[model samples]
Target: MITMQYRIVLPADYDMAIIRKRIAERGHLTDDFPRLAFKAYLYADRTAAYAKDRENLYAPFYLWRDTEGMNAFLGGAGFAGVIDSFGRPVVNTWSVWHAQVATDLSIATYATREIAPIAHHIALGELRDTEHARVQEDVERGALAAVTAFDPTHWTLLRFRLWRNVVEVADKNIDVYQVGHISQPSAKHDS
Candidate 1:
């Protein structure tokens, strides 16, 4: 599996309702898209009651079965619409080492992503195993969904998780967002 995300920082005064409406109206377009595992429509409002930062942003995260699906979406009109509205964004991608989802993914209301750099001396194989185990433990406990991926290009590891409720995280490197919608294209295969 592959994980991808692109963030677009909006103006401080930007109205976030526009993004909400956009998700409500078009988020389902990918519901049954081929080779797509899931798409999480996520956004953050600086003015929201639970916001931890003062920067508004529209960022969507995706899990794909392979590069074929990822490439198809990027070449499609849906992506074109995004470029038309927000200009082109620098998309970040990682090779997934582990992914687990609960039976009810629709209950996910919040999402968190943490990116950390891997030290030069660390064994990549061992690091991947450790992160995979951690994610399994998290999902077994109560996490709605969890994924661990790494980008060798930058030697960065990404830890992403979905929760059914709001969470208070103090880590400066972690980004939290409210989930507007989730498109599980391959719902039958989710586990």
Candidate 2:
């Protein structure tokens, strides 16, 4: 299976509350048609405390699956990029993992690759104007935890991509897979 990851920086003037509401209301009915695995709007503990106690106000981590269809259902809704309480542009990082080996090592490796591009992309992009922070470290930690904590045997990491816009898929990198990893059992073996 193939999955795409996107990280975007929301406009400073954007409204997060409305955005969350829109997401919940819209659900997975987007143009892309990708299945909604999970979605969260991340924030620091201090910020989270101040946030309105709403179920829609999630963290910065979200997962989507393409099992229902090949395309993601992100019709016209734009990605809810990072925005501060005051609606200022904040650096956002995201990664896509294509389950490759199904083994522990494979999952970990894909996770690392998934989050790595965010730092690189931000550094190469507008983030250069910002101060030096531990964004990379935080993303790395999150990616590590995601892969290590989740256990799946019948998965493989295939293609990884980082994007900002729903229309344009940017910075795509496809991972190599081993041969015969997904072969079907032979009928003769059933006897």
Candidate achieving the largest TM-score? 1
- Per-residue accuracy of model 2 over 1-191 as CA lDDT, tens digit each: 22333334344444556555644554333322334443332321212222222222223333444434323323322333223232433323223322212112112211222222223224332432221123333334333222211112322222221111112213234211111111111111233
Best by lDDT: 1
Tens-digit per-residue lDDT, 6-44, candidate 1? 999999999899999999999988888888888999998
TM-scores of all candidate predictions against the true structure: 0.95, 0.28
Worst 10 residues of 1 by lDDT: 182-191
Clashes by residue pair, model 1: none
- Clash statistics: count for each candidate: 0, 27
Off by over 4 Å in 1: 188-191
